[model samples]
Target: MIELAAIATEQRNPRSRHIDQVSTEEMVRIINREDHLAASAVEAIIPDIAKAIDLISGHLHDGGRLFYVGSGTSGRLGVLDAAECPPTYSTGPDLVQGLIAGGESAMFRAREGAEDDESLGKKDLLDKGLTEKDVVVGLSASGRTPYVIGALTFARQRGAATIAIDCSPHSPVGACSDIDLCAMTGPEVITGSTRMKAGTAQKMILNMLSTGTMIRLGKVYGNLMVDVKATNHKLEERARRIVMTASGCSRDEAIRALGQSKGQAKPAIVMLLLHISYEEAQKRLQAADGFISRTLTTASTEKGIR
Candidate 1:
């Protein structure tokens, strides 16, 4: 095992040395103040994050898949982000996937020992049928987790694009990846508790990568999730509202268009705005590669619609 004390994430914070001696309010304030550093650390790595986003977006545009591999809190965050992509951007389940060291059961509780087994990482990724067209993201706060390092190494050997997100500098994970987003969040307030600042930084970067890629793929329309899946009552309502917001139409008009488009927000909005049939709107969207902005602009110029 590595000497945890040598890791940046496991080091003690100078500001919080006496946290246990302080009052509850003081302790809370100390933690919150230190937490502010996480955002700055993430901001410092925006260029690297952008590179990963573009690579992933290009791969996905070419029908490639995205995979996130990690352990503990890092793994859970990746899984949460991947699971939300389907509902938010109406993507397929296979579009973005998350793999933890100890499988699904590890998500609910700690699987500390699983992270030490490097072979399991490669096995998990191989089971997913990873290919050259795919992109794999490795998440590890310390950037030395055997599981994450193994996955990234295997991904590179398979000719896939690999990205590493970590909170420590000069990370081994970074060395094995095509793009390394090392957000130096410094030491944790609680000392070695990376689930605090490190986890927050990872979550922020993951959000950017996934959200930016989706936007590039035309899942968003003017800041709204036009491709959101209306699988539940709340989402259905959101779909209606999105149509209304995008088309500048009345609630009734939006509802009617949504019904015509089978509850799809993008088509419904396009149909209402272009005053076209649902079938025509769908064709335009398909021709535009699912980009509502481009489809509407092309229709306006060619047919003088809207």
Candidate 2:
């Protein structure tokens, strides 16, 4: 009973009317040109995105979690963003989570019909033990996905903060949330194939939301991922490099400091820069709420006072 024609994402694009007859190079050019509009669309909604970031960051600071719920491409993007946070920011796995309509298997194969069952979305949140302190982000390109709407509704009912990310303005998912981010990428190059421009916009927005929240949480120091988990050899090297960059120490000194700080780049930098023991660095970092810059500044001020 939904009017697909009225949906901006479902409308036929006149620009790609003859895309089938165009040259291969022309096709690429056309798609690339259309992709450019995705950034502009996201730029137009900066204020809403900022508000969502602040809301999520505040909740997280208070020991709350963030959940992303969606279906299909939107769901996959949410999962991807959530999965990357732990390695990138050294956050716990429980901090940010992603829920899809058809569950984990849907991430591989398409579960197109599962998006219609609204109850499934609510069930997924319940399984996660969602609480009032958490934040839920709903992703739906068309803005009318029952799965996302249901998730947002349940989140609000549980007294949790809710945010919506969609491509259509004044969407149903948006209406159910506290903050709405509509990028309005318009009709896709392939008419209704939202996985193209809409997906890009969603990815960009998700990147901003997660990255901005992490930065505000002090996971970043001078644009470096100070809390990076050095699980792999490459990441270990990167951690040493990050320590060297942040503390202006030599490679050997950086490695020594990282070893002293148990391979933690933030405390390693703090140890080298403040000429303090690993335990003192840890205490200072804790006192500064894990902000490396703040810890260094406080140490310097205390030294001056003494």
RMSD of each: 1.4, 0.7
Give residue 115's lDDT in candidate 2 (0 to 100).
99
Among these predictions, the greatest TM-score belongs to 2
Model 1: lDDT of residue 161:
97
Model-by-model lDDT, in order?
0.94, 0.94
Would you list the clashing residue pairs of candidate 1?
none
- lDDT by residue (tens digit), candidate 1, 138-226: 99999999999999999999999999999888889999999999999999999999999999999999999999999999999999999
lDDT tens digits by residue: candidate 2, 45-159: 9999999999999999999999999999999999999999999999999999999999999999999999998888889999899999999999999999999988999999999
Write down the lDDT that model 2 would get. 0.94
Which candidate should be chosen as best, given lDDT against the real structure? 2
TM-score, every prediction: 0.98, 0.99
Model 1 Cα shift for residue 216 (angstroms): 0.4
> In candidate 2, which residue ranges exceed 4 Å CA deviation?
none
TM-score of 1: 0.98
Off by over 4 Å in 1: 304-306
